[model samples]
Target: MTIPTDATPSGLGGSEPAVLSFQDLEVQFATDLGEVRAVNGISMEVHPGEVLAVVGESGSGKSVTSMTALGLLPKNARIGGVVRVTEKDVRQLDARRLRQMRGKDVAMVFQEPQTALNPVLTIGDQLVEALQLHGVAYGNAAKRRAADLLAAVGIPEPARRLKQYPHELSGGQRQRVVIAMALSCDPKVIIADEPTTALDVTVQADILDLLRSLKEKLNTGILLITHNMGVVADMADRVAVMYQGDVVEVGSAEQVLVYPQHEYTRRLLDAVPRLGAGRAQLGIAAEAPPIITDEVPALEVKNAVVEYHRLGKPSFRAAEDVSFTVHQGEIVGLVGESGSGKSTMAKCALGILPPTSGTVAVYGEDFNRLKRKDRKALQKRIGVVFQDPAASLNPRVPVGDIIAEPMVIHKVGTKTERQRRVYELLEAVELPRAAFNRFPHELSGGQRQRVSIARALSLDPELLVADEPTSALDVSVQASVLKMFMTLQAEFRFACLFVSHDLAVIDMLAHHVVVMENGRVVEQGLREQVLHEPREEYTKRLLAAAPVPNPEEQRRRREQRHAMLAAFGDKVVEIGDVPHGPEGP
Candidate 1:
């Protein structure tokens, strides 16, 4: 059940209200420009036993405001607000007292578990100390609770996993462990900051359901921060739309999501790429004519099969009969779900892993049978863009030098020539000259991606291999980047192999579509043929699962639920039987 939004802002001090409320909150950071109001005057309340979703794009103060409530901001940061929790005003609380309250009264599950979790500590030790410090029973009590919490979060074989390190667990399992830790204290409030931002769709659905159920069962309030409206629609009881650090819209989930009143909210929703719906074209459009021949494709893969061989063991087939091509000046979109071996096919084309059989030829030169000099020459004509630009870029070096490195390595021109080219490349990526001097950490996620693109273009490659280039960016920024890619291809006439999990993006950028599943291509044809006129069950499932632009899709789900219950009589179906549930078969 949702809390009453019109509830008066009860004064903080004497007694605790439902839970952690931010009244007239304002957070600012001192910079050369001045005190940047990161979080403008905003008021929000997360009552006990409800999921309050805070939705916004980058620079929207979603993170900053949540960080303030937990007293997690830096010392230099100026915060003006009243944060109430555990019958105490947290904003004015002393450091030691606030420290005592955290992980007991409240806890947070961060976005990147790898970065948040201490790499050196084993999972058991981390959980044990976290529980013991909070005085949530000692020794075996804490261990037993930790194991139970793990299983509660759907982690398999908790006892065995306790000894395993963070690195040993996959991304999804690590997220589960993080969730387990969040619930260890049985905190009154849980702040999950973009908790499912990096997970796969199906995994994301599972995590959402897990959190929703946990919130209900434990009577814990949740301040869910995310940019995805689909996710917000699924789990939020109430939604607070933040723009320019201010809460522009705050209302029940049904009201805000179904009939968004604010222009900004509408724009934000509009910016979301509807994977199954959009333009009728291959979805990808080019401004200029393609620069390839009809006789031989720019890059051709013929019945390519790649295997990973371990000593004294049978080799595993990484990619089976994967065949596709990247024609010059045209884009080929390869779409798939997570763990579908999309990356393996990319690696094979890059020659990082040679295919066990079949042929890969670029511009009439065979890649598998090529020598070092020949392969190096081929590298000059192919560029790759990974999902996480921050990880790919060198932290120590500036953007200009990073971009110029590719040109310098290939010995394209003189020193002055290289410097001029770097400037031009930065300009092409729509980044300011000042960005040339800043390191990767100094820039935002979108800017870092632009730098990565600039570097990839420095070598003037004939083909670009982009893997989830826009997945990390905000929708508005993602759209702009897609347009930029189109413009770049039009100008340079370079072919692109765009790889993405989101079908809407693939449709908008790909001239043709190749759907991959279980390390093999299930469908490959014109974008319209593959996306709109599907011939496979998996393709239909992908389309049905795509993010809906309007709230009508939400209605469809409700109606579907109603129809299912109507047909199945009054017998209860397991929670896992629900479409978005864990066992959604």
Candidate 2:
């Protein structure tokens, strides 16, 4: 099933045979509510050496369609039509035969590698287990093969990594390990489900490069399932736009992304936040900068250095001389990679983690100098919105109670007053007042996050710390939330410290930007100065790694990134010159 290099990009009815194909696929799940039709007669295919991306928002049936291809749907699923992997019908295979077919014919790389991997097992153990399960190798032979797989995926010191547990590796390394396991048996096609969704921008670029390299080297087809339009631009040869259980549009990546025929596809593209677009692109009017005088800022950090004390080892420095200010009625975005101390700085600002040295001040009150009661009192004026709203809000508690709990703790008002405040907060966040009685799990991801925002604002805090608030949401929901956030901040005049890895998000919201790398602030200035015209190499690299939604623009950026990386003495992650994987000794 080899596709010619010059083959036509259109995938709907190609001349070359498909390595993976879905014919009139339909899936219905029998839930407590009734039968839910997840996929409706959607047909797609992945030719050898081609990347076919199935993209849509959450509950659009993209994931459901991919699940059917692997026969990974649950027992209650009522499936129709044919799913073929490597020209073999998946539904027709028996249990034992299905197990044999899975890793050999097709494989999957899940969104969260932490969940996909076994926590208790070493990396080598899991890799070896995968190899042995597919009868690829045995004992020491398997160990050698495992190391080779890791190296092939661009993980350095593969032999040393074999002994490390999942928790010991960084998010990027863990994803690489998962990818190694997927490539262990040398499947004909790989199903990657939002593989880079949880990664930092730089790490995501690396992983994308690795996947691209492997696809070319192994001549394997990839069925990429994701909601990120930038990733689709960077990866897909052909695109399938899924919406409410139907394939609304199918064409070459350029046609589908640039000149989308479907309304839903256009809407999806509209929702994507483009880098460097800033507030103007979102139709948010620019505000005059707040006047700064001798008056104290809302939150200030001066020469702050935070370190974690390890038992035998020297203290690990997380933030080194990190200094920044959030003025009244202003938003300052802290942008960086995962280990770059963005969250660490947020925690320190929230007073959850105290800096080992220097000072954190809130409106002229120094956190380190204040007495216990005084410090607690100062904290009353500060609000915090965490990244994942589901974890932040208590599942058993009603939304009203969750929002009013802060007011209750501070003893701000009577019970009746608190109820009134809760209703007001709900309206402020654009959630219906009826939502006050519902629990966290009963709401959608967007609604839950809105509840989290309401809870954070309950006490009418003058300062707000939002830590990756919209990272987990779908594009449209994120757009809605971001718009609401800007409006609320303007109305409330609250100074905010927004911590996120997304540069585009920061560009949309932040008046000032702080860029960090390896526990130090490399650049800080006005948003335009730092993001658009960055002077620091680290800042430039971070901006370069952030993908744009346009295919042509993204291709240009990718080329510039490679050139920049080479000039800066860095290398892109490519398949290493290791032993040819499953086919070789």
Name the lDDT value of residue 132 in candidate 2.
83
Best by lDDT: 2
lDDT of each: 0.74, 0.85
Q: 53-150, model 2: which lDDT tens digit per residue?
A: 98876678877888887788889999999999987899998889889988888999987788789999999999999888888888888999999989
**lDDT by residue (tens digit), candidate 1, 284-386:** 4533455476756767888988888888999878678988887877788887776667777777667676778988777777876789998888889888887
Poorest lDDT segment (10 consecutive residues) of candidate 1: 576-585
lDDT of model 1, residue 203: 59
- Model 1, position 224, has a per-residue lDDT of 94
